[model samples]
Target: MASLELKIEAKAKQLGLGPIGIIKPQAMEGYIHRLFERMLRVPNGEKLHRGFLELFDVRQAYPWAKSIVVTYADNSIYYLPNVARKHFGKFFLTDNRYNINAPARKMIASLTAFMEGLGIRTSWNEHPGVTGLRWAAQEAGLGIIRRNNFFFSRRAGSYVSLTGWVTDTDMELRSTHKEEPCPEDCSLCIEACPTGSLSAPFTMNMATCISCANSYTDSTAIDDHKLNVLTGSWLYGCDNCQDACPFNQITGYSTEIDFPGLMELDHYLYPEIIADLDYEDINDFIRPKFFYIKSESLWRWRLNAINVLINTGSSDCTRILKKLLKDPFEIVRRRAQNALELLGS
Candidate 1:
């Protein structure tokens, strides 16, 4: 069994997935339950469940589940936007094209097949799954949850995506290595947060997060201050916190796997191009990769773009804002009107 586990670990590393470890499902129950309870207490905490602990009743999903194989793929934040802009001439947020979720899913599928070939039954989960990835990864000793509320591995910083597989096979469990990856004196990420989302050390107020505000499907749900915070050139997700982390400066891009979709940047929409977009353009070009924004939430993108223009304070944006004043979506029209007011045009 030890030899087989070694083989599996080597195979995973060969497949460009690693910092792998194993843990018993029972070990995670208490931590997950506590985390779930806390999540329910926060505003918009209901939405956090899918990524945190909603579907992840390990005993229920994997009745025979004995161990979870937690694995992470190197997703250095440097390569993501840099490669997209170099190839596609535009910056990309953490969408399908640049985010590690897509590659993590691919790794899970491949790992499942590999385990099945060795006569082991395996089930895997990604974002909205029966496994809470961050907790599981931390339990498996792959990383530590830092003060910024992101998983930070010694080798990968916070620039990796997590995935896991559950199986009936009783593998040797990795010892839990509880770590405080953050330096005691450094609070750069907390200070850099524009919306005061990082309320304290290792705490996050998700409702106030600029990234959450940018991704909100309903533009009306966000107030003016949140809107202003998001207006600072962010169209989808905010990287201010990550950018401030000193540990993230270490290079992990060398080990990053060149996944297929990383180069597919046609879906990335820029601020200068938003005023010219119609429903057809969005449906045909942007909808496929940026699916998280949703078809009904198309106005959010327009609002983000308008906010970007407003933040730039470019007089040239007046023409674009005027065009968007007649936009079919009420949210776009209203945001555009407000943007014009800010522009004093």
Candidate 2:
């Protein structure tokens, strides 16, 4: 008969996951404490600290949860082509819309169903919860925490999506201490950051991060300088740090067939497309998988499109900016006015 760990690993592989790791729920205390201390110094850190306490209390919801199983699916290579063509060739819009949470959710759902069939009880944690998934992944021997504050698996680099669950089933925990994979002197990701968000090794100022600044539902929080610093290319997510990593450059390709291929230039945002886009076009074509923004927040997307057009510095974009001057969303109109100023129109 197979051990419970072996059975779980088999089930994970069958679901198209990259790796599986296990740890005792009680063993996560040290990692949680360190994270809590770090979270205390950031903006809105108090609220985050409180949230972390609730989420990291492994025994709070499932007192019977003796063990935790951590799993990650490869994503570094999953969207490389689209990202490359977008940044280097100025081709398509490279958003993480396709492969963000969908794959991990599917894998977790399948694993839960399989575990239930074997009469084992389980509970999964969604994102923004107290699971400390990246830290938990480090403790489970799945990866190391790199200087950019992302989990780096030797096999998957920094492009892995993590999912975790607590269970009543007891499993052997892997060693918590593993040699760090990053070189002591490497600062590639840090040097690539446009906003200096990477304050130090493994430290990030979330408020200024391009990924957070652009996608944040509150468009008013970001001022003009930060918006310009986001660069004109990225629409939804930023990959400057990851793209600059030597590790990612070498091991970023995946064998997954379901991933989308390199999108053509036409698939990206252009002056013509931005001029014609409306609410229906945004809902049907622009929204990525697992859409989170509200109807009122659609202006953020429009603002991003306007920024991209401004980056082109084409006189052609002046007309589009003019059309957007009367947009109902005050935020959109303000940005269009900014674009016109940038274009000297």
Candidate 3:
């Protein structure tokens, strides 16, 4: 039998991963139980068992889908609005909802496909009020939670998304590890969040979070111009707190089998053009990497973008907003109209 480290190192390289690590399951036993319990404490957690079981039932897919330390790149800024704007958008700025981006979505889909192709089923869970993935990832020694309340792996920054496959293959357990201590004087993440959602270290007010808006399907409409402005340069998912963290600086880009490729931030920040994407365009060009964007809940993302662009008062965004008035997607057109009205008012 190969040593745990040797096997994991080979797997990481085969998957185009960056530096890899390991955490023994025994080391994570207590932490995983607590994390599972904590997630179950959520009101909706009771309903998640079906989903979890559905994922587990497909484990027959991959014979080699062993549990090793999975790692990705550290493109921290790519997920946030400010950093993404530099790379993707021209008219408006918003968060990089990878679910909608062509490259990112493709990567995610490919990963899922790979898992299923191996006869294993994968569950991509980001349910509200539950942190099972977080607990699992953290317990697996991928990274520790920082004061900014985001997972931070030593190799990849907070930019990595969490998704995993459970397989019939039980490989060696890597070491269970934790994040290094935070520096004494750093509070950038706390200060950068405009809505004060980072109310306390490791405790967030999801009800008041911009990211929360992207996650919910039936929450109150957050079409308020004032709230948009406070979203602080994010279009879909806000990363103000993560952007402010000093520990994230120690990270580098990912080497995962695929990272979101080729699309710019504009794809996410501008509602006027994105609403016009046909299903083929979404599936062929974008969906493989950003499957989450397909969710109808993206109305919140478009609305958030409109508010920020209007608040910037950038003339370039004016025509884009105007064009969006007749969008094929009613949600886009409605949000555009409301934004234009807010701008006029």
Residue range with the least summed lDDT across 10 consecutive positions in model 1: 86-95
Across 1-345, the per-residue lDDT of candidate 1 in tens digits comes to: 557577778778878786678888876876666576656556666675446554456777679998888877666633444523322211233323334456555666777898899888788654444577777888777778777777778766776767778888988556456545687888999899877777566666666666666666644445565556444776666767776888777745543545445445434555667556887777666655555577777777777677776776656689998999899988778877887786678
Q: Which stretches of candidate 1 lie over 4 Å from their true place?
A: 33-51, 81-105, 175-180, 218-220, 252-268
Q: Is candidate 2 or candidate 3 better by TM-score?
A: 2
What are the per-residue Cα lDDT tens digits for candidate 2 across 206-263? 6667666666665444565655545557555667777687876666454453344334
lDDT of 1 at 219: 40
Worst 10 residues of 3 by lDDT: 87-96
Candidate 2 pairs with clashing backbones: 55-130, 77-252
The Cα local distance difference test for each model comes to 0.67, 0.67, 0.50
Q: Deviation in angstroms for 146 in model 2?
A: 0.3
Per-residue lDDT of model 3, residues 212-281, tens digit only: 6543443453654455677654545665676567776665332232223434423533543444445355
Give candidate 3's whole-model lDDT.
0.50
Question: How far is 237's C-alpha from truth in model 3 (Å)?
Answer: 1.7
lDDT of 3 at 214: 47
TM-score per candidate? 0.84, 0.84, 0.63
